[model samples]
Target: MAHKEPPSPLLLVRGNNRRVAILVISILSLLAMFFLTFSPHLAIRHCGHGEQQRSMATETMSFSSGNTNDGGVSRRQARFTDLNDLTATSQAARNEEHVLILTPLKNAEAYLPRYFEMVNRLQYPHHLISLGFLVSDTTDRTVQLLQDRADELLNRDPPDDDSSSNNTRYHSVSIFEKDFDFELPEDRRHEFEMQPLRRSFMARARNYLLSAALKDEHAWVLWLDVDVIDYPASILTDLQSIDVDVVVPNCLRQTDENESMGYDKNNWMETQQSLDMQKKLDPDYVLLEGYFEFLTGRYLMVDMPTHLGKLDKVPLDGVGATFTLVKAKVHREGANFPPFAFQHQVETEGFAKMAKAMGFGVYGLPSYLIYHIMNS
Candidate 1:
């Protein structure tokens, strides 16, 4: 009889509320199970998309950062997107470019004083220029003289009032000594028959100096022969303005009363005869300019009239290192003076051939003359 009395209004209301709460809880549980079964695929898709975007961003960053080594591209190729960009930076910002001046010396004591004087007269900021020398196979006091002069040039004190004097000191000086153990009697050094052997040694010396002195910071390289007696103070600027990968001024022999004649025939353009002759010769046989034995009839830059404008440039197939200017990237890309025959030429001429083969322009300024001491 007491159980039958459970039909009270308050009790009925409480029972309905409990059933409603339980039904709501059961619906929520079913919804959560459905979400757990499908939501993992959606979450994975979103995360995968984000990961793909991050990978693409990382690859773009690597390319712009010049990390070409990882991509198998050369540093030289990565630095300039286009080869034509090898031209020097604007003249207004020329001081920003660092130039390495390299000289390969052999018994050059007699010329060091004049060479230093010429170096001192250069209008290019000395602080932007580094000096490098390779002393190879010498019997003279060249090393001592070079050391003494380097000391004087580097250690010279500037007058307190001269604000520009600090820029007169070279950025750095590096002297390297290595002997090739090859020698020619002084009297026969320039003989036609001895030129091949002599120049091969010279090539080895130049390569050694370049590899030793070339630094990542250098933008240009000036290969200067120590025997050059005279050049314009603006030679560096003049050559750079030509905007070629490799350029040389006409090398002339100094004569009494300042008259000059072509001294370096190494700078020449190949003639049909020369090419034909090269094909017939042994691959190892080297060619020579200014020699009667191998007459290929190549046109010499020296033969070009000197009355041409100083900045006037002509394409060259070969070049002499006597006051040559090269873009540093050219050497970095593997163009160098071959000690053996390269395209039937050796040393400086071989270097020109190599550069041209590598798709770089080689040129000469016929009227931009630099004087070489008369060979003894």
Candidate 2:
């Protein structure tokens, strides 16, 4: 062993310590560099993935349903979006066209489930639409059912998905309930007195519902009758594209012959003759629908120059609000279902007159049909 002399222990220790320090520093530096570089890279990748997930989700998605059947008809998509905020903000968000589905619920328990099912099935993003219910004078489990649904909605988490930003929960599920001492024979609302006692109260009820349900006037108000049983899922999309001050989709009911009839009592093209005649009638003359059933027939036909190749916005004098879409400004400008007569019209008709007076275009979609549940 020609080691000239055993290297001094101190020297050896110092050399070893120096190499150890260098190695430790190198390892720590490598770790720091890796963390600084790769950590950000990982985080950026994660964020990008999240964003892509949301984008892709909204881009490619349909409904998931098939629980309830209508007389043995197997359903394809869930009748309603249920609470999922799917289609939270579709293309309609371009001009900030969100809608408040305002419903005045009265004795709607039996139909609530089906109603919601149909509503959820609407081909619009539930998130962009706030559901407002003014439950007045309901005796059945309508309020309770609404409460249960509200609780479920409140507790439901934003659906777990790669993309759920816009499709998050709804904007609001407001349910304002109170008792109105008024009573209309559940089946015969039209049969009862149609004057200050009946028609005016109906207007008041509608107005109250509007006041309570409308949350500011940033979005259009779609006064959807709770009794509507069937409607196109794309109803929202179709109506929004009409681009009018106010719009009403012709609602139809199935007659015993299995044919259809215009069910909207207030939906009509006011003729000057009808107008003058209406003026001559008793001040409390109730506006009756279906008088020209045989002449005009029922069923709206796609018969005018309109948009989307499947919708028409016909000028109207007065139409029903069975499924009316009123611009928020119309109400913000004091156009509402008046409790008193307005130009020989009352309630929804009066609302139309007010809108007209305000120079707001009131259009009707005749060909586009929505079904209403009768008795059942």
Per-residue CA lDDT of model 1 for 86-153, tens digit only, reads 43553612547888999999898888989988998887877788999999988999998888878877
Which regions of candidate 1 are displaced past 4 Å?
A: 1-87, 90-95, 159-167
Clashes of each: 0, 15
C-alpha TM-score for every candidate: 0.75, 0.67
Deviation of model 2 at 202, angstroms: 1.8
lDDT of 2 at 16: 58
Q: How do the residues 272-309 of candidate 2 rate in per-residue lDDT, one tens digit apiece?
A: 55656655576754554444422232223323322343
Q: After superposition, how far is residue 285 of candidate 1 from its true place, in Å?
A: 1.6
Local accuracy by lDDT, each model: 0.84, 0.70
